[model samples]
Target: MNDHSTNKPIDESWVAHLRDLSTGVEPPTSANPHAMSRVAIRRTRTRRAVLTTGGGVLTVAAVAGAAFAIGSPTTSGPLLPGAPTSASADPSMSAEERRAREVEAAAVRALESGNVPAGWHVNVLEGLVYALPPEIVTSGPVQDEPGVTSDMWHSSEDPDSPPFLRMAYVTPDYEFYDTKASGLTQTPGPDARSFDLPGASVATVDDSAPLSEIAGAPEADPDRGLVKILVHREDGPGRYMITMNLGTADPEFVEGFLTTLTLS
Candidate 1:
């Protein structure tokens, strides 16, 4: 019997088989151990792939972080929404400021992906994007324990004009209009009419409640009146309430405003 264990070199045939199985590429002609290892590494990387998608853009993040999108001409740019266009971060910028800028950029990318029209103002509050028309100005994402409120108004020369909309994006654990310490009344009565809107599964409109009872506004117009619309998010556990003041028009105007909204 032949004793092969003492002073035996690695079997060359076994190494060649492993190299062929792991990576199907011809080895270098100058097949030193180091050169063969390099060839295997290179071939393995070239054959590997990872795929991801965002906002209808399919991206393949491959070797050295190079990405390419499908159905589009190849140009090397980050296809993911909210991906930083520039890698360099300012040394003086605080973490909060950087986060704010990142969120803003992400919202902009989202709006573009949604094809929101020009002349629209976007408000990002509590990670939700609210895109409004130029005619509709928004204010105060006033944060409290109950929820966050963002009031909308018609862009006018007169400051006395009553706000057209009051939005409340409630906390995840709470209802749209929770009867809590915020003192905000939950006023969408049983008589509220239900309707449909994109990105929302359930929507309701109630014109019966007084504006004062809706948001406790000092500028509530008793005669012109207002309408309350509550929307339930289609894909998630979230509810948002929008109280719209019907100035000179009907409830249809509110619906028209809602069509322009891009929520993500």
Candidate 2:
């Protein structure tokens, strides 16, 4: 009988025969069948672990990039249009300062408009512009000494009114004298005080003696109260002396008018 009944074909049995020949042992059978399956399972697990680790590393790198971008300091951008900056940004101003600004602005607006009140006239002379009240009549320049030019305003109603307004422009050669240096004694009253005027230095004299005395006038009206203002010019070499006799009206009204004077 042939041994072919128990033998397998060579094509299917050669792998086991080769394995046994290499190892010098008989090939394994059904007793150890899962050896190849365990190797395949370990390979699959290792590949999955590598892919998961790579994905985690990529996620960490992306997060770090985003954090750096967010935490970096940046330069400031331009301000919005029409935004107030510098000195104007400060809003705290005293009431007196605010009033002064408002008055100055109003005077500017008035000068731009060029509209004087009815029956009132605006005199522009000696590098200045000021308004005269309706009740005062402007006479021609008073006959005064050399180097001194003056415009006199008298009350329209009273021929011999003691109260009047006098504005004088003095030349550089004319001696500049003030109450502080006149050596004339002042009657006990409100002391001399300085005031705020745009582009001018102004002082108020409320002494008992008439302003004419301090201004070296030949005549002094003791019965007339005077509101004398010494205005230091901002643009030129001369000063303006404004005197308003209180016989015209209230002293407060005269003060208000003096405050309205603006430099040309």
Candidate 3:
């Protein structure tokens, strides 16, 4: 699909490149060796539980401007202030601490507003709320290793298909700097086109490439192929990784979806 706003066609080459990257590299090994085993164990356990439970879809309740999970209720209480400025400003504090403070501040602002955008649902868990599109289906919050909470949403008609969206929130104790650093290192080549978005960095790649990662899948389907949008942000007390895998290649839809994002 083309981005009418920019009059440029969406790129598909990077999607294939990403699939190759996912398969080519070994499973990610955390920078902290001591936490690796625990993360693995927790991930395995969570996966098994989700499979056995048939995946629980979280129900959200919109109150004023905030969204709250029906099962995991959160109070619309005032947030504490006093978050530090940027890392450069705080020489005595560690990177993780500074990021945590920023995340906390963002969360507070989100909670204070309690606003849920139109046509989106909120997945509230562990004192955090995320606004997401209604077309996507998820099994509440999935654990992506220790200190990391992940929520994945895919087409309800085909759970095995590529996900429409995935949000991973990393807690303060986890090493978010290393995680973000690893992703930043995988920069796209000069051929990839870039786009502008509020509060985000965007890029696109399209080419006639074979699909070697998924068997029996078409090289590129008009309605469904590989469209990966990676958005990473560190706010008040956490680090968020939001990914959008669209089947229609509609950049407008991606942009609209992102505009609705609110973290409380």
Q: For each candidate, what TM-score against the reference?
A: 0.47, 0.46, 0.38
Q: CA lDDT of each candidate?
A: 0.59, 0.62, 0.51
Looking at model 3, residue 195 earns an lDDT score of 45
The lowest-lDDT stretch of 10 consecutive residues in candidate 3 is 206-215
Highest-TM-score candidate:
1
Q: How do all the candidates rank in terms of TM-score, highest first?
A: 1, 2, 3
Candidate 3 lDDT over 1-264, as tens digits, reads 875575667579988888888887787665986688899999999998886565332223234225233322244443347843334433678877866766666655644555545666655433344556676788565657776777778877787765556656656566553343422212343444444433434333321122213223365565543443333332344455454555545755655544445434
lDDT of 2 at 216: 45
Runs with alpha carbons beyond 4 Å of true place in candidate 2: 1-119, 176-190, 203-224
Clashes of each: 0, 0, 18
* Residue pairs of candidate 2 with colliding backbone atoms: none
Clashes of 2: 0
Instruction: Please identify model 1 stretches exceeding 4 Å from their true place.
Output: 1-118, 140-145, 149-154, 172-188, 210-212, 215-223, 234-236, 250-252
RMSD of 3: 44.9
Which lDDT value does model 3 have at 76? 43
* lDDT by residue (tens digit), candidate 2, 15-37: 87888788876576664548888
